[model samples]
Every structure is written in structure tokens, then in C-alpha cells.
Target: MSFAPEELLACALARLIVARPTAHVAVGAASPVPAAACWLAVKRGAPIRLSLLHKRSGNPFTEGSRELFDLTGQGRVDLFFLGGGQIDGQANLNLIGTGEWPGREVRFPGSFGSAFMYMMAGRTILFREEHSPRVLVERVAHVSAPGVSEPGVFRRGHAQALVTGKCVFAFDPARGRFILESVHPGETVESVRAATGFGFDVAAGVGETPAPTEGELALLRGPVRDEMLETYPEFCGRVFGRRAAA
Candidate 1:
């Protein structure tokens, strides 16, 4: 059977998570769609250091979100994944306003602690489900979080690997440039170009991203899915309604 977009995205994210080196913890925000899906990599038996941020002390969780920030501050987190409303060739992301600003053409959800996480994390993984000229642009409207303000420092700390509907890319360390590393199944260089708004470097003889393995599917259908249902029962209830119980 063919995999749906969500399943394709889930598998791709799972693969990316598996590729990351181990760390003490992995912190994802309230919107855990990507995080939950990617957790399958760990489920599939890929080694990873991960834990969910349920809530704060005295509020209701085993550990607080502060741990994530503190760990990153000390350079403990090895990898993280983030979605963006807009991205550039430099991998500088924008999750804030879209148009002229304040009361302009379009407005978007403000940056959700992206500034701190992007600045302090050891490595960042960026993915965009919708790949189109408007979503991937030459430059962002504003720097929601500074990627490389004065060059050397921020640039070195910020190593971004971007995955989109059509292709996968990693920023070149030398110039902090985004270079196409691989194309997804059935995707071509031309298709990637047509989807993106800016120019990006493509590696010579780039290959297709490997498909997800059986192990990954089991992980998604097992512990990971159950945990999400239990941990976010209210959210799940909203999606599936009261019928979720049956």
C-alpha cells in the first residue's frame, strides 16, 4: 500500500532523528506533531536520548520545560527539529508576521521561543510540510531568531539541516549556505527548483532519500502512538472526539 503524506513525512522525520547523535534529552514544544512522529525513529530501535516535556514542577509534569532551555544553555542538546512558516537559503527561519508588519497583508503565529532554542541548540533540523515558492523564499521578512548576526559565532553554532516536501539539504559550513543533499523518492532537481523560491546548491550525483523501514512503522503504531494518546488525551479527544474511547 502507498504511504500518505503524513506517513511519508513521519518516516522522513524519523530517519532524520535517527541520524542525530545522542544527548541527555530532546525538547519539543506544545505542538508535538513532528516530535511525536519523529519519535518513531527511537521506537524503531535507533539509539537516541529523548524525553517529552509534559509540564512544569507544581503544575503537573515529571520535569519542567526549563530543563530543555537549561540543557541547551549548557550545550547539552545534540539535535532538535522545528517547522517554519518561511525559510531562506541561509536557513534563517521566520515564524512571525508575513507581510508589511503589525497590521499588514498577512499575520502568522508569533515565534514560539524559537529565538532561544535556535540560538542555543547544538544542532537544528528544519522541516516544512508545504513546499512552494511562497514558503521558501530568498529572504525572510524579518529574522524571528538571529541565525548569524555577526557571522563567526552564530554561524558556527547554527548548523541547520532542512527537509522539505521535495528535497533534503544541509547548510555548507564555509559560507553558511544551504546545499541540497538528497531528493525524496520520485522527486527531481527540477521539481525542487520549481518548488523553492530561492537558488540552492545541489550536490553532484545526489541520491534519493531512503524509504522508511518496517521497524519504523511498528514504532509509530505502538508505544509512540499510545504515549501521545495518553499524554495528550484532551488534544486527542478533540481530534477524534468522545468516540476515541471506542
Candidate 2:
């Protein structure tokens, strides 16, 4: 059966979530892809506690991100999703914009709690669909969040993986670099290299990313889509052909 790119990405992310011992997953307000992946993992019986910050109803927090921050500080949030206007090989995020302090050239959404969440969360999965030299850079103009801390610093966790449109990269906190794990269909190592600005190591015998299984496709098209309809109606309609009621 055919599946949209979003569904494929969600399935990939679900696999990553279930691959590890994830007890709780938190998705940010602008992250529809991670939210869908969290729901898919639950539907697949991963026993993961999902916290959708943008849920229209039954939101877990009462006073916005304050409670979320509190939980993250207490190490209750196991996995979180983060993205930036620019990400470097070291996984440092640049949400401050491009050029100059405070990004006088190209302004992006200011970083609110990314540094805290990145340091305190058990692990982070960086997701950015647009994979280009502009988005993936050699170095971020500003460090909104440092992917790896120096010795003697207290860091709860680091980025586990970065999912892009072209491939999946496994991050190595020890070396502070990315390793190409798999290339998506229709992409090759050369293509990914051409698109990326930073250098990375390639996994030996790198292979294609596995397509969504039949079971995964069923859940995404059915229950997963249902759960996302309210929070991500436009995404559901565009990718799953299900529209929310007016």
C-alpha cells in the first residue's frame, strides 16, 4: 500500500521511539510529525506516555510550559523533539537566526527553553523536514542549544538521532558528530552529501530506510490519523485525506 511521506516519517520515528526504553515522550507545539509518531507508538503498544503540548483538549499542563519545564527538570520527560532554523554537525541548534548576535540578517523564532530542555530531557530527537545546506550548516550562527556539553558539566542526555527528509543520522555525543545511518528511497550518499553543508561519517554498509510496514500503514491511516485530526487538522487532511469538521 502507498503511504505519504509524512506517514513514512512517522513510522520511522515510531520505530526509533520503540527501539529504546521510552517511558514518556513530549512533543512541542509546532511539531506535528513528532506528535503523530508518539501516537503511532502508543497504538503499536509501545506503552509510552505521550504529552502533546498543543493538544486542543485534555492538555496535561495547566500553566503552559512552566509545568513541562518542571517535569523535564525532574527527569520525568524521557524524549522530546526539537528543531532549529539551522543545525550543525555537532547538533548545535541556531534558532536565533542568521548573521550577527540576535540574528539581524534573517530572524527566526527566538529560543524559549530549548537549552534547558535539551540538557535536562532524557534524550532528544531532532526533526527537520527541509534538508538543505541552508538549513543544515557547518556551524550555527548562534548557539540556541549546545548538543554536547564540556566535561564536568551536568547533562542528562543528548540527541539520539536526527531525522531529515533525505536520511537518518545517528548522533554520537562522545565525538559530537553525526553518522549517516540510512538513506531514504530515491536518495544516495552523494545526494545527501550534496545537500548537506556539514561533513559526517557514513555507516559501513549503509542501506535504504525501511518502508512503513503493512501494520504501521494501517495504524497511521486509521487510529493515528483519528488522534491527530483535532490537533493537526491540516496535516491530517493533507497527508491522510481526513479533514476535521467545520
Candidate 3:
């Protein structure tokens, strides 16, 4: 059965989420895809907890980010999703836009608690639908969150993988570089390399990303859609042909 690209990406992310021991997963703002993936995993009986920070209503945290931060600080959050205006080979994230310190040229949304979460969370999964040389830079102009801290620095975790529109890259924190895991359908290694600015190692015998199973598609279009309708109505409508109530 044919599926939307968002559905494919969501299935891929759900696979990643369930691959490891994820007790509590926290998703931040402007992350409909990751949120959908979390719900998909839960619907599949992955036994994962979700803390969606951008939910419009019925939000888990009454005190907002303060409570979320407290959970993360206590290592209760096993996974989190992050993206940036720029992501480099070293996994440094730059939410502060291009140009000098504080991004005087093109200002992105100010980094609020990202550095803290990046350091405190058990692990992170980076997602960016737009995969291009500009978005994946050789070096970020400013470091909003360093992927790997210095020796002895108190860091709970690092990035696990980066999921882009073109491919999936598994981060190797010890080497401070990404390793090509799999390319999305219709994307080739050469094509991904051409679009990427930073250098990365390619996994041996890397293959195309597996298509979503029929069961996975059913869950995404059904239970997952139901769960996300309120929080991401536009996404649900576009990807699952469902709309939220007025």
C-alpha cells in the first residue's frame, strides 16, 4: 500500500524509538512528526511514555517547561527530540541563526533550555524535514548545544540519531561524527552527500529505508491519528485525512 512521506518518516522514527529502552519520551515544540511517531510507538504497545510539550490542551505539565526540566534533570526522560537552524558534523546545534554571536544577521528562535535538555536528557533524536547543505552545516556559527561535552563534563546523554528527509544517520559520540544508516526511498548516497555540508562515515552495505508495514500504516492512520488530532490537526488532516473537531 502507498503511504505519505510523513507516514514513512513517522514509521522510521517509531522503529528507532522502540529499538532502545525508552521509558519516557519528551517532544518539544514544532515537532508534529516526532509527536506522531511517539504516539505510533505507544499504539504499537511499545510501553513508552510521552510528554508532548506543544499539545494545545490536556498537556501533561501544568507548570510548563519547569516541570519538564525537573523530570529531565532527574533522568526520568529517556528520549527527547531536537532540531536546529543548523546542525554540524560534531552534532552541535545552532538554533541561533547565521552570523556572529547571538546571530545578529538572521535570528532564529532564541535557544531556551535546549542546552540544558541536550545535556540532561538520557538521549536525543534529531529530526529535520528540510535536509540541505544550508541546514546541515560544516560548523554552526553559534553553538546552542554542543553534542559532546568535554572530558569529565556532566552530560547524561548525546544524540542517538538524526532523521532527515533524505536519510537516517546514527551519531557516534565517541568519534563526534554521524554514520549513514539508511537512505529514504528515492534518495541515494551520492544525493545525500551532495546535499550535506558536513562529512560523515557511511555504514557498510547501507540500504534503503524499509517501507512502513501494513500494520504500521493502519495504526498510524487510525489510533495514531486519533491521538494526534487535537495536538496536530493540520498534520492529521494532511497525512491521515482526519480533522480535529471545531
Candidate 4:
């Protein structure tokens, strides 16, 4: 089955989540893709708990992000999703803005609890749809959240992988560099390297990302897609399709 990029990516991310099962997974704002992936894992029968901070309904937290912070701080959440306006080779995230701080060229929704979550969560997956050199930079103009905290800085964990439109990168915190995991279909390692601003190591046997299977597509379009509509009606309509005649 020919799957859309979003569906393929959802399957890819779901596989990642399934490989390393986590008890509790937290989905943050502007992360419909990751949220869909988490739900897909569950629908596929991978036992894991999903917390959707962006969802209007089905979100258990009545006090908003405060509870999310509490869970991360307490190490109750095993996985969390993070995104950035810019991400560097070292995995540092810049959600604040571009140029100098406080007075920048572009302003994003300034870093709220990202710094805390990035440091607190056992595993954080960075997802971004755009993979151009502009978005993947050699170094961010501003550091909203440092990827690898300084020694004795009290960081519990760091990024595991970065999923983008073109490829998937596994971050090696010890090496402080990203390793090209796999390139999506219709994209080459050379193209991904050319598009990225920073340097990274390509695995010896790098391969194309596996396409979404017919079964996976069925699940994604059915239950997985339905669950997303409650939290992301626009996204569901835009990527999957509009609900059945209301």
C-alpha cells in the first residue's frame, strides 16, 4: 500500500516506540505526528500509556502542563516528545527564536517547560516535518534547551532519535553527534546530507526506512486516525481525511 509521508512517519515512529517499550509516554504541543504514533503503537497492541497534553478531551490533566512537569520530574513518564524551531548536530533545541535573545529575527512560542522536560524525561524524541538546512542548523542562534547537559547539571536523560520528513537520526549522547538511522523513501543519504547544515555520521549499512505495511496502514487509517480526530480534528482531516459525513 502506498502510504502518505505522514502515515509512513507515524508507522516509523510507532516502531521505534514499540522496540523500546515505555510504560508511560507523553505527547506535547504541536506534535500531532508523535501523538498519532503513540496511539498507533497502542492500537497495534503494544502496551503503553499515552498522555496527550494537546488534546482538548481525553487529557487527564486538569491543571494543564503543571502535571506533566510533575510527572517528568518524578520520572513517572518514560517517553516524551519535543520539537524545535532549530535543532543542531549536538541535538540542542531552539524554540525561543532566531538571532540575539530577547530581540530576534523570528519569535517562536518561547521555551516554557522544554528545558525541564528535556532534562527530566528518560527518553525524548525530537520530531520536525521540515528537514531543510535552514531548520537543521550547524548551531542554533539561541539555545532554548541544551541537548546534552553539562556534567553534574542534573539531567536525567536526553534525545533518543530525531524523526524528520527526510530521515531518522539516532542521537548518541556519549559521542555528542547524530547518526543517520535511515532515509525515508524517495530520499537519498546524499540528499539528506546536502539538506542538513550540520555534520553527522552515516551508518555503514544505512538503509531506506521501511514502508508502512498494509496492516499498519489499515490500523493508522482506522482506529489510530479516529483517536487523533478528538485532539487534532484539523490534522486528521488534512492528513487522513474528513470524518465520515459528520
What lDDT would each prediction earn against the true structure?
0.67, 0.90, 0.90, 0.88
Per-residue lDDT of model 2, residues 1-246, tens digit only: 666788778878888898889999989854688888899999988888888888889997898769999999999999999999999999999889987889989999888789899999999999999999999999999999999999898999999999999999999999999999999889999999999999999999799988999998888888998898899888888888842232
Q: How close is candidate 1 to the true structure, as a TM-score?
A: 0.81
**Residue 132 displacement (Å), model 1:** 0.7
lDDT of 2 at 131: 97
Candidates 3 and 4 compared: the better one by TM-score is: 4
Q: How many pairs in model 1 have backbone atoms within 3 A of each other, for residues 3 or more apart or on separate chains, i.e. clashes?
A: 0
Worst lDDT run of 10 residues, candidate 2, spans: 237-246
lDDT of 4 at 235: 82
Candidate 1 per-residue lDDT, tens place, 1-246, comes to 344444556676666666656553354653454556546766666666665665332332344557677767788776766667788877777888677764165676777767877777777778786789888888988667654556465422565677777878877645768888888888988899888988888888788877656665556555666656765566445433333344
**Candidate 2: where are CA atoms >4 Å away?**
242-246
Per-residue accuracy of model 3 over 41-90 as CA lDDT, tens digit each: 99989888788887778888988569999989999999998999999999
Least well predicted 10-residue stretch by lDDT in candidate 1: 54-63
Decide which is better by lDDT, 2 or 4: 2
TM-score of each: 0.81, 0.96, 0.95, 0.96
- Compute the lDDT of residue 164 as modeled in candidate 4: 97
- Give the lDDT of residue 212 in candidate 4: 90
**Which is the winner by TM-score between candidate 1 and candidate 3?**
3
